[model samples]
Target: EGDSFRIDEPIYLYIEPIGYTIKENPKSSYEFGFFADFTIEGEDGKVLGGQKDFAKLDFKSWNFNTEITLTFTYTISFFSIQVFPQYPDLFSHQDNQ
Candidate 1:
């Protein structure tokens, strides 16, 4: 009974893709993956599922020291799956006249 959710809060986090060119490193493999990055045991007991999606950052037009933020949005679903929203950091508002 600890899984509480806020209707107006964001549960998903967006990751921006950084296309860093790979140079030959003597100590590391050319292609490797990080295993089991997240482990959670909050008061909310246990989480059923989660997902991640990212967009490419256009570095050609990026400022050298700019702080960029990527956003991902998701919704909780039944049957152990998360219904994710398309795109990131999207908010709908009526146009101000």
Candidate 2:
């Protein structure tokens, strides 16, 4: 889940674009393409990590019935560290009751 995360842990993200209906333009003359990039967003809507090498979808020779399934994978790691409390000292010297 996005809400839970361990610091300094490496995470991978696989993104896919769906539900895109392409319409043919008989009158217009233009090329179509798409640039897919990977990004990680924090809980406060901040970008923590992103991929520089973006996947490009070239549709120069593609038709209107073309189905595009652009998948991108990104590897990210957090700089923060997880702090764990030491509880061994609490029961180090226990009294017999």
Candidate 3:
């Protein structure tokens, strides 16, 4: 799933999930999912790691295997979004990706 995330400097790392609804639970046009996140020490080769909860998707694209990597000299955040397909249809889709 080639998913990754990284924040340079100081940022809250804003995010939102997109994909499916209650009734139909169909695939959404925008479904963002966070796979991994971590921080690094500029001066030294140190790293700060964190875990992700796949239970909730933050952003999504059509290709689940796309390469999304944010650069910051020390670390980078990789991600991808794409609507593939869901179980049901006629579901209320939220415009968040």
Best by lDDT: 2
Note the residue pairs that clash in candidate 1.
none
Q: Give each model's whole-structure lDDT.
A: 0.34, 0.43, 0.31
Best by TM-score: 2
lDDT of 1 by residue, 19-70 (tens): 4443334544343222112222223335333333223333232223233445
What's model 2's overall lDDT? 0.43
Give the TM-score (vs. native) of candidate 1: 0.29
Question: Model 2, 1-97: lDDT tens per residue?
Answer: 4434454334444344456545445655334666665555444455655565466775543345445454433233433432223321111111112
In candidate 2, residue 72 scores what lDDT? 38
For model 1, the superposed segments whose C-alpha errors exceed 4 Å read: 1-3, 6-44, 52-62, 80-97
Full-model lDDT, candidate 1 = 0.34
Which residue pairs does candidate 2 place in steric collision? none
Kindly give the stretch of ten consecutive residues in candidate 1 with the minimal lDDT sum.
87-96
